[model samples]
Structure formats: C-alpha cells, structure tokens
Target: MLTKAAFALLLTLTPFFALAEQAIQSQHSCFKGPFETYQGWVMRMASTLKKFDQEVFSAYFPESKFQQVQQTLDCVDFVYQVDGFNVEGYYLKPKLAVDKKLPVVMFNRGGNGRGGYVTFTRKLTFQAELAAQGFIVIGSQYRGASKHIDNNGFDEFGGADVNDVVALMDIIKQIPDVDSENIAMMGWSRGSMQSYLAVKRLPNIKTLIAVAGVSDVHQGMAERPVMEKVYKKRIPDYENNKQQELDKRSVAKWAHELPANMPILLLHGDKDERVNVAHSTRLAGILESLEHPHKLVIYPGDNHGLTKHRQEMISEVVGWLNTYLH
Candidate 1:
C-alpha cells in the first residue's frame, strides 16, 4: 500500500536506525579533542564501537591518587595518523619550564592487546612523575591496543609496531617546544623489546633505559606461553617460521646493530617472575662483547617494573636520562 517515494524513504532510514541502535549498544563516543586533562575512553575518531575489537581486560587504577597527581601536571590526549590508521597517545609537559627546547622521553608501554594500552591513570602518573621533571613525555597505545578505536589491527609484537613509536618521534619533532635533538627512550617489560627494535632503527635516540624487558623472543615465548599464543595468532607465518620471526623481535641476537655511541641503562629486578632477570643479564653480556656503552643494574628483592623499589627506580631512570640525554 506504500507509495514508491515512501518505500524509498523507509529503505534510506533503515541503515541509520540500525546504526543508531548499534551506537547506543556499544556506547561509542566520537570524542576528538584538544583536551585540558587526562580522560580514559576518549574516542579517537568518528567510528562505531563495532569497528574495534573489544578487549576483556580492564586496568585497575587508584582514581583518587591519580586525580591528585594529575592536578599538578598538564596533559593532553592527541591523535596522529600512521600508515593510514589513527593512533591515540598522550603528551605531557611540566607545569614549569626553564628551557625553550625541553628534552623528550618516548615512554614505551609493556604488554600486548588491552593489557599494555596506556590507561587514564597511567597517563596521569606519567605526567606527574616523568613530565613533572621538565621533560616532554610521549606514549602511544600502538596497534591492537584497546584504548584507540582504530588500532593498527593485530599485535605485531616488535614488527610494524615499532613504526608506531617511530611515528611518535616524528610527531614529537613537529612540536616546537620539544628538544628533538636530545631524545631518550624508556621501556618496561614488553615495551623494552619495542625499544630495542626502535633504537636500532632511530639514530636520533641519545640514550636508552630498558626496565625488565624481554631481550630474547625465544626465551620469552618459552617463559610466557600466553604470549606465544598471542604471537601465533597475529603473525602470518608464525607456525612454520617461528625462529625467524622470533629473531626479528629479540635484541640479544642483534646487539651489534645498535648505535655504538648510544648509551643504554638496563634495569632489572632479581625477583621478576614475568620476565626473568637473565634477559637483561644476557643482553648486557652481548653489549659488553660488542663494546657497546651500557650499564646493567639488577635490583635485589624486586619484581617486574621494580614495584618494590619504585622510588629508587624512578630516581635512577631520571638520573640516567639527565646524565646521557640532557
């Protein structure tokens, strides 16, 4: 009984109605902003939640402490297009600045999938602790992370994911206040692997600080079975080309490729269950063999990330950055 024009109108409205329903169900917020402070779940682009691969893990943060800390620092959530994908990250600056060109620290996060994505609380803490020390701090969610709606697809581990960090460097260089020449890298756990790959490729890196990082992919896969499964799922030829793919990720096998002048500060905890202390130890041996300038510090009675010696680790990291990057 409907007229032809009415039938056409109904068809046109059907997709929009379904889209509206989907948006409501997924709670998608198209938030692209120059935000004043840190906020979690800030939308990266005008995309539906259905487009993102939902993650199961949720980071537990002490909101009150983070709120207090964030008040002292200035932070913003920004996006940069990399390889045709919109990557979300945080940029932090100290409240007080003494120099026009401040040194930069590219903070590489650990973990794959949702586990490693930078949370709102993490952003606040990084700003308060690191950025407050008069350095510009940049951290990306990378690809396959839950924070960004359009992540780089699946976890490439240390493969193309390294480009995300490199792209962040390019993004930092464009910022007028950042000291592009004086750049340092700080990576923890899985991020250390990314850092190792990145440092070998990025010549501008003045110094490196790798904390409880996985230096050997084979050793890491043997230690963490869960990671092996994740890698197999993401890597195309992982089943047949296991060792080859792993060698590409491991730094212990290719320490000589790193710039000789680039000083590295290796920090590890003796009690690190997540990533054994031997990873750093073995890499240190390789660096020494290669006569690469580096320092390896193994903390006693500390877990991964040195949670027990948090303050001491921060002090050492800041000192190392000042000594080398500054």
Candidate 2:
C-alpha cells in the first residue's frame, strides 16, 4: 500500500470512471454496490474472454478483467460524503454471507494521493479476498486520491483526512447488513498512522492491524526523505507548523493514549526500506510498557511491502480479525 508504482494503469480508466460516475446519485449518501457501471460492463466482457482466450482478452481490453475474475469476492468502489467532501473508497464482502449482519473490517490505505491508490486490482483483490472470507472489508481513498471518483478537498494525511475515515464508520451504519457495532480496522504504511489516530476516537474498535505501518512521522521522514516531501505536500501548513503537525501525526508520541482493551496486531518486515521496522518494534515496546494487548510479528529479510510473506500476512490478519471481531 506504500508504493506508487502499481497505480499507473488505473489512471487509464479515467474515461470509464467518468461513465461510472453516472450510475450513482450524488444526493444518496449510502448506495449499494454491483452497480451496472461502464467499468463493470467492461470487466464482465473481459471475464467472459478470460474464461477461454487470454490473448484475445489482453488484446480486447487494456487490462485484466479483475472485477469479474474473483470467485466469490464481491467489491464495490464507492464515493460517499464526509464533512461536505466526497470521499472515495470501496467495500468488499462475500457474495454469499452466512450472517445477516456481517462484521466490519475498515481498512486504511497507505500513500498520500495517487502514490498509494490501490483499487482496480492490487488493493481491490486484497480487500476482496478478505470479503470472500466473510468480513465486510471497507476502506477509504481519503479525500484527494481522485483516480476515478471526482472527490473534493485535499488529503491532510492524518489531519482532517482522518475525518474521512471516522465519517465512514458512521456512514456504514446506514448501509444494510453491516455490523457497525463490531468493527476492526487495518492500516498499511501511512495508513497505519491514519488507523492509529482514527482508533483513538473510536472506542468501539474491536482490534487494530498495522501492516508495515508508520508509528512516528519524524523518524520516518528522517529515514525516507521522499516521504518527507510527501508530508510537505499533503500535510497542510507543513512549512510553519512542522514539528507540531508531525507530532500530531506520530503515534509514538502518544502510544499510551491507545485503548488497552482494544488489541493490536503489528506486522512489519524488519528489512523494510520505506518505513523502518523500528516503527512497529518501538511502538510494540511502548505498548508493552503500557500493558496494552498487542502482538508483534517481525518478518525477517522482508521489504516494506512484505511481498515475500503476503499469504502469511493475510493469514495472520484473518486469524487476528477472527479472534477479536468474528
């Protein structure tokens, strides 16, 4: 969720996005998914071709028919209102859910803008996978990550943008079959920071999952200068407020503030180059000192994305969510 590389192809869908925008009524705050949008129509065509001819499918469409490729993973890329701004996000769930009201998994993605956007395949497939497993996987594209949805306002990283996440919590309650009372949140990379801040206000959060998360802004900026530049662009008043803004975003400065009752699962690769593993480990230690309920998993020889241990990470996440939220 940290890398900006995989989002290029998604930009190509801008025309299709414009078409899909017609499916939703802006007056409606909470709309159901599987809408007959132009993109969905394209994917249906691609899926039909993928069943037989790969070459033809590739030739016909610019990308894979990912939306229809999944077995039972139903995903909905949605746009909703949050503090007068249209926030972009998605929700994933199994086509055949066993429960009348499904437990919630609100995911927070990493990256500032197009940099961390994952909707078409990467993030969509990941969240869809969890949905296939029975949880309602809902996530935010924050405010300004406008790949498809014409969202308003700027992404304040963990500042005002956090309200985007919090607003989704209340918004989902209106969406039927969602177990708003029992909620679990997972944040990846910078999304981890958003998760930390969002959970602070959400006492109802059953559990927190931080995958390759950032616990400290200052420490992360020092290690990854590129990320510092990102901070400057996304975080408002970065030039003048600097340390104050960074401190406000950094969970390391206030680890004790987290609820001891709500358990946390910290997943980080020790060899991570983007955000140092020290972020999770140090935060884990602080949480330990504070007697918080948490489990830290440090994968050896893994990078920022934890690409090598993705399946294992998925298992750990699913297992943790089951333990607390299911």
Candidate 3:
C-alpha cells in the first residue's frame, strides 16, 4: 500500500513518465514545455528548479573575472550562494582600450569534477581572442567541485546549472563594461549540457554553442565503455539511481523547448572516444525537425574535446559569438 505522500508523488511524476515513453516511441519528436500539473507541490518543485538555477548562478559568480582589470587578460575569482552553499567560479574578462562595451561570453567547463581552472578552459589558444574581439568571457562552476559535495539530488541540479549562467549575466550587468544584451554561452561535455539546458529554459540568451555534448546520457554511456566501468566502480548498482539522474540531466531532450529564432551552434568530432558524435548528430536532427535556428559542424579526426583542431575550434566559436553576440 502506498502512503499519502507516496501516492501524491506518483501522481506528480505520472505525466513525465508518460511523456518519456512517448518520446521513446517517436524516436524523433518535438519537445514541449512542462505540462501543468494539478498537484501544486510538483509545480512548485519545477518552478523552484528554475529559480534555484538562477539564484545559484548569481551567488556563485558574484563579481567580474578579474580582481583588477589592469592587464589585457586576467581571471577573477568569485562566489555565489545556492541553496545555502557557496558555489565558487572564475570570471575571465577582457580589458580593451578606450573602454569598449564588449559582449559577454559564458564558459561552462566539462566533467562533474571540472571547475574554474585555467587549464580546463579549453585549448582555444586564443585565450585573448574574445577580448581582442571585445567580449567579456565568464567561466562558471557548477556544484560538487572544490569544497562542494556531489549533488546526489534528483535532476542533478540541472535547473540550478541553468541559473548559474543567468546569475553570471546579472553580475555582468552590474559591471561597468560588459554589454548585457549581447550575451552567449558555450560548454563542453558536462558543461555543454548545462549551457544547452539553461538556454532551453531561459530564452533570453542571445547565442548558444555546444561542443562534444551528448544528446542522451544513456546512449552516451553505452557508447563509452569507460563511463560504464566508472559508474560500476562508484556504485555497484549504477543502473539504479544513476540512470534516473542522467535522464534528468540530459540537454538533448530539453533543447527543443528553446525558442525558434535563437542563434545556436553545434560542434562535434567524428573520432571522439569519450562522448559519441551521435550526440550532436541526433541533436541536429531534432533542431532540423523543430525548424530551429541552429548550425551543426562536424570535424574529422577530432577527439572528445576536439583537441586535434583546438585552434580551429576556438576560431570558429569566437566567430560564431561574433556573428550573434557582437
């Protein structure tokens, strides 16, 4: 027999499950926004996820990337409060002469462990390229990295990750130099999911970019044998809760909900070993079917991070942002 709360929970989750089954059936279908539930609690939870994502983003990145914008390039450390936790991140802003009002670029790093480190900031060797082009680059950090515990909660802080970028934008608006209207976000791997989903929920974003990000976590895990091994090592029953969490975190499922006219770019490598190229391939199909404004670029002989053509990737990313953001 189910308790009252358990019964209520079931009722709340019923639509999502039904929708998931429908999605699986179609193999290719349009993603609609969240269905209104009669249960107020569930609605509150979804609303909270969106608000929490925004607040956590604000609290985690409270200031500009640099403590002093004396040099042409510098990384600044900041903190934002999320669910009572202090989430830390690095802000990388470019200082241009004559005080240029630069477009803002948000960086979402890869992996659950990756954070505001300079090394993982992508090998886009043109670190100063964005600045040269007059853009304020913000590198955000999600939960479970650097003093934060692993987010074992359902949805894996997916909505909260979206909030982080939005909050960062809030911080930028307060800054003296950055142009709030021309803002874009780009992420690789885990960070790509964060950026992609954030844009879906919040369409105020002007530009979007994802690199080597998987459309479905289950498919991604299936393709990468090492990830399965990793899951098994960490949790003997990886198929249990981990699967649930990944489903909640995947961006491919939610990207279609994004507004139709937003400029979005997808980049992937053919020979990637970590995350399959199918992630982007499948995503492109969804975007095309939905008739969304998006461009998918496939690179040959590139790996997980697009390391083979790092410079080319950066040039393209900066170029994309320039077209939309600038």
Clashes of each: 1, 0, 9
Shift in Å, residue 131, candidate 1: 0.9
Best-fitting candidate, scored by TM-score: 2
Deviation of model 2 at 220, angstroms: 0.6
List the pairs of residues colliding in candidate 1: 143-152
What tens digits encode model 1's per-residue C-alpha lDDT throughout 78-107?
Answer: 555566665566677654546577899999
lDDT of 2 by residue, 80-191 (tens): 6777777777766666646477889999999887778764545444776687667888888888887556546788889999998888775567545678888998999999
Whole-model Cα lDDT of every candidate shown, in order: 0.73, 0.76, 0.60
Model 3 lDDT at residue 11: 42
Write model 3 residue lDDT over 65-154, tens digit each, in one string.
Answer: 211222354444445545544455554555445455777778777765333333421212234456555676776566445553343121
**What is the TM-score of each predicted model, taking all chains together?**
0.78, 0.80, 0.68
Ranking by TM-score: 2, 1, 3
Candidate 3: which stretches are off by over 4 Å? 1-70, 114-127, 148-162, 225-244
lDDT of 3: 0.60
